[model samples]
Target: MADTAGDSCQNLREESARAVDNAKQLQDSAAAFISRSGTEEQSLRQRALAAESTIRKLRSSLDASVRRGTVDVGVAEKIEEELCKAGSIITDGDVASFLPSIDHGTFLKMFLGPINVRATRKDVQLKVKEEYNRYRDNTSFLFLIFPSALLLLRSWLWNGCFPVLAVQLYQAWLLFLYTSLALRENILRVNGSDIRPWWIYHHYCAMLMALVSLTWEIKGEPNCAHKQKGVQLFLAWAMMQGVAMLLQNRYQRQRLYTRIALGKAKRMDVVWGETAGVEGQLWLLYPILFILQGFEAYIGLSLLKTALVGVVSEWQVIVCGILLVVMAAGNFINTVETLMSKSRFKAKMKRSKSKQELDQGLPPCNSRLK
Candidate 1:
């Protein structure tokens, strides 16, 4: 019995040593892999920056010529259009080809869903960009349509002229849309998008609210009193959001286009539409945004009160109310940041243009020259 015990002890010691050796090997391998990944990321980003710098130099030359009155405004814009093509080529060939697949891209494919079949890392990133563009376009359209329809036909809707079944179906549609958009945004973040984390959290919150609201009983007398009023309020919220969406869609696209033109952003596969004309429009947009934000806050507070007072004591309502307030705050903050940044950029550009003209033996303005 002693001899048998000794042999068993020796075997266990050998197994333990082997396991430790294997673990050490794995640790070394993981460290080496991570080092290689960092090196590759650094190299690729440097190359992209070099290419971007070259593009910016060319754009600046054209801009300078425009400021000096040597190039026609229309001609400079055309040149910019051509330069956008060059930017596209570089993005596709140089940058995209070199990028590594991020962890979330693989996770996205494994779990929720992928909108496209992406065989390579570049393919995944491109697909993410494409899907995001499509999602934004869809939302812009839906926000306008649903809100306008609800508002224009509110009286009829209140009287149950719109079938409960139809309303439910529309809500389902919205739920699907919001959920898909959130997933796509996650995938985009994985693909190197600079989307704020707060926005992503906001989407998650919205999806949860949508899901909970779907379970809301919109018909029948048992719980119809408060429930129906909630639905009506929701419609009004949607209408307010619709106006905000339209403004954001139009203004933000133009801002993005301007950024791309200035070489601050990678060019997208879309036309640079008519100029934003934002200089004279801030008075209109800001007030509208402020009103919308206030309204959203009021609705969220009301919902919270109802839930807290046990007027409609579903846990989902409580959670959704909290989420609504959070989302509204996030939205407002993001909007303000964007507006401030754009305003600063425009001011700087104006100052630079004026300086350039002065340097070129021209006055800052006709009145100044006179």
Candidate 2:
């Protein structure tokens, strides 16, 4: 009976040990599950934070757009899509495991959304055309008249040799004639006006002027100080003019690209209708001209200083110096104004994009996000 009791007690102890082992296995499984769940929760929280930040950035962008007075519906939709996707990644179980595929181009498109939308508008096209026309007319007039007046004034003031004055006058006249011709070509291109022989005449004359200027620079004899200075000025002017023409061509090409990209018109249509060449010419011309003016200013200042220290008259030096200063100031102002306008336009575009995003229920992004 005692032996039976001892065996029964030993069996009871074995059963208790088995129970403890089963409990430990259950506890281990629970601990592992809890650890995995905690990690997933942490990951989801991180995703939520990221999504919230993106949404906020999008919202800010939208607000900027409203101030710019332009609407971009497509951009708004895109922002909304991004927001939804991001939100899903944060809240949805399976989706949370995957990262959103974002890229620089995608972000850039979003940032420039307003510009893309506005560029597609018919009214915007019309406005751009009108502005181009106005610019062309003003530029043509200035190019035709200003150089002629400057030459005439120089001739009158300098009392320089007849040959020098004659050469300068002839060059000025040729420049004016070519500019008029270029303007006509440009107008024809824009209005679908008939092309005329005058267009060819202007192109030929411009090429002739360029060749003549180059030849004169190489072959002309400078017998006097005045003659030497005049030749130097003329050479500088000619070189700058040629550079301007090249730049103008590039500008026109860029403009054509811009128009096509904006879907305002076809490249062929614009090319056929407008003398994009003139636009290119101006683009090349202005910066070079500005630089030339700056150089001229420095030259004038140097001349003035030399005159003061030497036998030359102070009055003549002062007058030339003043003219150079005036030209430099004018060029500087024009350059600055142009830069400012471009900057303002870019800012407006940014604001417009932001506004569109905001309208679509997205938060604006920080300006620094881009």
Candidate 3:
């Protein structure tokens, strides 16, 4: 009993020390930020002070959690996330503009009601998670719904019915999907999720394309001789996206499960479907992804060519085409980099296993005797 009590006390002390260290680091970061801002020095200093105030509140909450003899992992993670974001603002000149908004938001809550500030912060964090899950659920539903709906709609629209309305609906759907994706990506980033920046950038470009498509007129618009062709191409792209999402949702979940089993990922997100896997990627995921990227590029170039030939003179169409090409190039490069990294990692792991077997003076299992 006494040993257990001593160990618990030591753990508490360690946590307290960590909180202190985090506080000191935050102070240093804020000081550096204040020194760096030239004309906006005062405003920057005020924002830093606000961030420091938030850090202190977080430390207090941590202390309370520790004293209660039950640390909330969620709270701890939130604190860490907020600190990282604040630190980034302080150190990264490119993101310094965001500090003002952060400061304003943090201070506004504290000023409105100091006593409930912690509760308010916790509520906000919980809401972020809730909204993210909601977004994912909606995306999965739409991924299935949109392609099927478009496929059916295409039959009617291709014949003599309301082609303008059909085109408008399609564009609207794209806008919704891309906007939601961009918002979700931003939320994930803010929550300190380890999503690739390239993926977020991809969503940004996609959103741009969708926005441009919103203004695209089909029937009555001039230079729209290839409108029907464009519709067919977009429908094909939509169908491909649906299939790609289905495959990705399945294989990525399995990959996450494998990662968790191998002590790679900490845990799987509960929103995904049931998963079963042991090790190594499915290989199928990459081929599907490559195909989707290729399709996107092909459709984009086709649209660009149509625009160049005066079939569509709108700048929005031109810009959208360019963004699609950019996204395709970025996706390809990113995918290739990921594949190479995974291969290298697998090779390293195999070498380590072989070394262990050799150290044990046992022939590799694949060896044959003659």
Candidate 4:
């Protein structure tokens, strides 16, 4: 009986030792797997970057060959499509999970200056844009109030007295606002956000005007009266512009979301202008934008008229007026161009759908009625 009990205890001890050995093996295997995963992650990013460089070079060469008539146009186009697919894979895949997907292009670098504004992750890049949009909305409302209040003080409380201090402070704020907007837009361009170039240029013009406004001399009482008209016109225009901006950001963003859900817009794309693709909102947004543009041009012409009639001949007024007119024209052109492009896109889509239906032996819905 004693021998039997000893043998059973020995067997138990052996089983316990074997269990511990198996656990140790599993721990070692887990450690190896974790190390290998880390190495592969790093390797993946490096390979993707290399691939991107090679692909760019290949594309450049192909473009040059096409331009020189060395490659068949059809073949070149098909190759370009394949290259684009490969590029998209790298951009949208885990390769960029912890790395920057794009550099600030030369265009943005010129505006943003020499610095790396690259974000580490996709979410961070998107958050920067979201913050900029919010900033624009808040500041636009504030700007609207500032000019409105200033004009009221000058007309009622101050009895047409030029509020030099108040006006100059407003100019300073304008400078700061434009500068911040330019910086944010440049950063957005760097982070693969597609911002319209003219919009950024408009801010540049605004910044210049703000600086000029700061330097303008506002003479006391009687001398201020003639120049006051120009200043007042500018103020009114600014107020209208602020309102337009608020409406633009609100409706454009809403339109952007709707299109994204409908698969009409890319996830990375944001609204570029006041003109939205949605019909229900366009009825409300475009008229206001057109009116604002007209008002801007009118103010500019008025300033020019003042200068011509010798009411106010300051270089500042002339420059500001020209800038304003130029901005109005550019905004008008951009809006029209956007509308035309959208129209063409819709027409193309309709044609494609009709062709597909015919190929499938299905008559068009309109044809069914006929």
Q: State each model's CA lDDT, in order.
A: 0.68, 0.52, 0.62, 0.80
The parts of candidate 2 lying over 4 Å away from their true place are 1-166, 169-227, 253-290, 302-321, 361-370
Using all chains and alpha carbons, the TM-scores for the candidates as numbered come to 0.61, 0.34, 0.59, 0.73
What is candidate 2's CA lDDT for residue 6?
A: 100
Error of 2 at 280 (Å): 14
Say which prediction, candidate 3 or candidate 4, comes out ahead on lDDT: 4
lDDT per residue for candidate 3 within 32-78, as digits (tens), equals 88677654756655777687677768778777887796886645757
lDDT of 4 by residue, 309-358 (tens): 88788888899889889999999999888879878988988986896677
Cα lDDT tens digits for candidate 2, 1-370: 9999999999999999999999999999999999998898678657766776777787778757755746576666576667755654343323323333222233234434422222322344445555544554455445545445555654696444334555555555655555545543443333322233333443544545433443342222443454345344644454454445444545665666786566433422333112343434546555565676677567557655645765344354445445445555655665566557656976988997897677668544664376
Runs with alpha carbons beyond 4 Å of true place in candidate 3: 1-134, 157-162, 220-225, 267-281, 362-370
Tell me how many clashing residue pairs each candidate has.
Answer: 0, 29, 1, 0
In Å, residue 142's CA in model 4 sits off its true spot by 1.0
- The digit string of per-residue lDDT tens for model 1 on 205-257 reads 77778877777655635655565555666677777777666666667677667
- Mark the regions of model 4 whose C-alpha exceeds 4 Å error after superposition: 1-46, 49-89, 92-113, 223-225, 262-268, 275-277, 362-370
> Which 10 successive residues of model 1 have the least lDDT summed?
268-277
Candidate 1 vs candidate 4: the TM-score winner is 4
How close is each model in CA RMSD to the real structure? 13.0, 26.1, 18.9, 10.3
Which residue pairs in model 3 clash with each other? 223-311
Which of the two candidates, 1 or 3, achieves a greater TM-score against the reference? Answer: 1
